[model samples]
Every structure is written in C-alpha cells, then in structure tokens.
Target: MPGSAPLTTKDGRFGYEAAGDPASQPLLFLHGIGGAARAWRGQLDFFRDRYRTIAWDMPGYGGSAPLPDVSIAALAGALQDFLQAVGATNPVIVGHSIGGMIVQQWLAKNPRTAGAVVLAQTSPAFGKPDGDWQKSFIDARLGPLDRGETLVTLAPSLVNELVGDDPDASGMDLARDCMAAVPGATYRATMLALMGFDLRSALKAIAVPTLVLSGSKDNNAPAPMMAKMASYIPSATYVELEGVGHLANLERPLAFNAALDQFLKANVTATQVTA
Candidate 1:
C-alpha cells in the first residue's frame, strides 16, 4: 500500500496526496462527494511506479478550503489553479462521480488540456435539480443531516449501501474512512452543486481519448446511462465491472485498475511514449 502525507497549497486553498516523481507524466485522480484524496490510494499505489500519481481533496474536503459558491464552474476553476500550482501539464485525468462532473466541466472549458480522461461511475446530467427524482436524491442524502446525523455518523451505513454485494474488506474500510471525514457542510453544498450540472452537450467535444468506466450494479449512475454517454464521446472506450456498485474503485480494485490500466496503455501511455 503506497501512501504519503497529504500536501496543501502554500496559500491553503488546495490540498492533495502525491506519490511518485513530479518529473513523470501525471496521473491525477478526483474522488466522489463521499470521498477524500485517500480514496485513491489503491490507484496511486498501483500506478505510481510508472506515472506521477496525485489525488486532490476536492475543495471543502480534507484540508482544502471551502468555496463561497460550490458549483461545477467554480470547481473547474479550482481544478485549473490546482493543476497550475502542481505543474500538471496535460495530465492523464481520472474522475469519479462528482469528480467526473468536475472533469467534464474542466474539459468543457479547457478542451485540450488533458492527455486522456477517465470518467468512472458518473452521469452526464442530474436533470433539473428541482425535478422529483433529483429532489428525492438530494433529500435522501441530506435528510440524515437535517435530522442531526453528521457525516461521520452517517458514513458507515451510507458506504454500505454504495458498495457491491461482496466488496474488498480493506477497500470497504478505506471507503468508510474517506466518507467519515467529509465535512457536513461540504456534502450539502456539493449535493446542491450536483443538481446544477448538465454536461451532455459537451460530451462529443471531449478532445482527448476517453474511458467511461461503469459498474453493472451501479444504481446511482446506471450502466445504461454510462453506455449512452460513451456513445457520445468521439474516442471513448466503455468498460463495466460486474457485481460492483457506484464505488467501483473501492468495491473491486483489481477489476477497476485493470480497466484503467488498459485504457491508459492504449489511449494515454501509447501517446506518451515519452513517459
């Protein structure tokens, strides 16, 4: 298990965990609303030998500062700053859930910046934030907090519902720990932020090769929706891991890593013969 002390920007606005050499082509990871930078440990450990692995604690998570306005656009702006700060030029970007949405927003605005992209267990849109389904979702997550259940107290049961029937024990523990650390306010703000995201129109404009990773058992971002999303991207490869749910990376690291590794080799590394 490769790991390191989490690092923060000198100004204290951004925080992340980095492993491997900065000289290497970067492998940047973005975790879901329920997760923090450490959720990417399995990936950092697996890919650090060949790529510079870095995982950010999205604004408001970990030591990162909370945004005055938590929107996709704002997150993307922060992402740009983080990239510039860390000197991650045309990095191979991997984003999961809300992280995936942020990546889409970043690519939508800065189309040519990434060497390749990976969107795992995410959707193109949340539909109208006020719509019935969306409201239900927002309520399901926030209702607990509204009733005074903090993220730390709600994390265990929340993670249990997110994982597959049989998940990796250590991975489940890691996922729980990550979820437990999320700030309650951050979760609320991010949930509302998700309501405003709609990136379907920008999918075809994705400039780099893309990997759309889905989990067959994912109810949050269903497999069918992800498949259709892949169809919209110009150069997209779709891979669905069976028996896994929304937390595919933590639910089944081997299958998730294999899909990611293959995508990087064919779409990113092959292009980066320099690395």
Candidate 2:
C-alpha cells in the first residue's frame, strides 16, 4: 500500500488500507454488505503499481465507527465525505453487490464522479419483496441480528446465495468474518433501506463512464436486472462473467480484473483522444 492511514470526516473516522503508486490515478473500492475494504485485496494487489488503489471500511463496518443513520443517501454522503477526507478527487469507483447500489445512490445525489464499475448490484429499489425470499432474507438476517443474534453466526447463511457455489473453505470463512463484523443495527438498516430503493429513474441521469458487470448465475442480482440497468444508462457498458454468481469480482477475480483493466484503459484513452 502506498499510503496506509485513517480518514476522519465530520460524520466519523474511517480506517483505509491503501496500496499503489501515489502519483497514479486513484481507484476507490466499495465492498458489498458484510464486506470490508479488505474485500478488495486482490484488486489492490493487482492494480497498485498502475493505479493508486485504496479501499476503506464503510461507516458501521470493519474499522469505521457506527453510524446510526443508515439511509442510502446518507451512506452515499458519508462515502463522498470519506473520499474528500482521503484526498481522492474524481476517483474511479468499483462497487460490488450492495456496494454497487450505494454507488448508484451516491451518483444520484452527487454525479461528479470520474467513473464507476458496478458489479452485481440489486436494483436501486429491490422492488417489492417477492414470495418469502425477501421476508425470509430479512428474518434469517436482519431480524435475528437486530435482536442480538450472533452476527458472525447469522451472516453466512443470510448471504450464502450471493457467494458463488464451490467457494473455497478459506474464502467462505472470510465472507463469514466480514459479515459478522458488521453491527446488527447497521445490517438491519441497510437491508431496510435497500428494500425501498428504486434507482431506475436516476440511471439515465448519470453522465460518467460506467461499467456494469453481472454474474451469470447470480440469483441475488440476476443478469437481466443488470441488463435493465445498462439500458437505462446511455454511457454504460455491460458484461456478464460466465459461471459466477453475485460476487464475480471475488469468485472470478482474474477475469473480472482483466475486463476491468481493459474497460478502464479504453475509456481513459478515449477521453484523452477526445480531449
């Protein structure tokens, strides 16, 4: 990591572990729910020399302080503040799953982004929970955790579907640990905020270069949904990684990184060519 430091903002202080060249373009990573900045270890390791790679624990997760306010907009604001606190201006953001939705919401409130990579995010509004899946997800995850169920014990079962099948034993444990570390209230608040979010209308308004990556077998945020989101964004490029679920970046890091590197290079080059 080029610079490892703690970030302090008006809302709270955040710990960010960074790796890469200080002079390179900054790339900010936002992990999914139950995930911390460390979730981007693979990415940071790969891109460090070429780009300034930094990932931080969001408020109420990992090393950051708890945030009682859990609204999507509030989360977005906190992210924005964190970015400023860390001195990343016009950064390229890569977000996975719930983190992806947070990026969308972040852009909605403040669209001055350099670029974005949205991976396997659910719809802005998860829409009305269908069948028992929604309620079941809530009951199994949010409800128990809120009431004092062991977060570590309860997190894996709740997000098992999001993780691809055939995850290595070590990878599975990492996922569980990340989820467990998140506070119960934060988890519940995030889920509730996700339930009512509908960002379809806001998509077309985004003007930055964007990439939407989908996991071919993701039940949590299916390919069709990512496609729908792509259609709404005039500048968005959509790609589906085969044989992976929601966590494509984690499940298939090499392929995902290759695609990402290509997209970012092409986009940055085109911008320079046009400029």
C-alpha RMSD of each candidate structure in angstroms: 1.8, 3.7
Off by over 4 Å in 2: 1-12, 128-136, 146-148, 269-275
Cα displacement (Å) at residue 255, model 2 = 1.9
Question: Candidate 1 residues 1-275, lDDT tens each?
Answer: 65755898778888999898777888999999999998998898899888888999999999899999999889999999999888887799999998999999999888998899999999889999779999999999999999999988888899988877799999999998988888899999998998868989999899799999999889899999999999999999999899999999898999999999988888775223233
Candidate 1 clash figure, as a count: 0
Question: Can you write out model 2's per-residue Cα lDDT over 50-122, one digit (the tens) per residue?
Answer: 6778888977877787667777777888888787776775578887777888888888777866655544455
**What are the lDDT scores of the predictions, listed in order?**
0.89, 0.73
Which segments of candidate 1 are over 4 A away from where they belong?
270-275
Q: Which candidate tops TM-score?
A: 1
Q: After aligning candidate 1 to the native by TM-score, how far in Å is the CA of 183 from where it should be?
A: 1.1
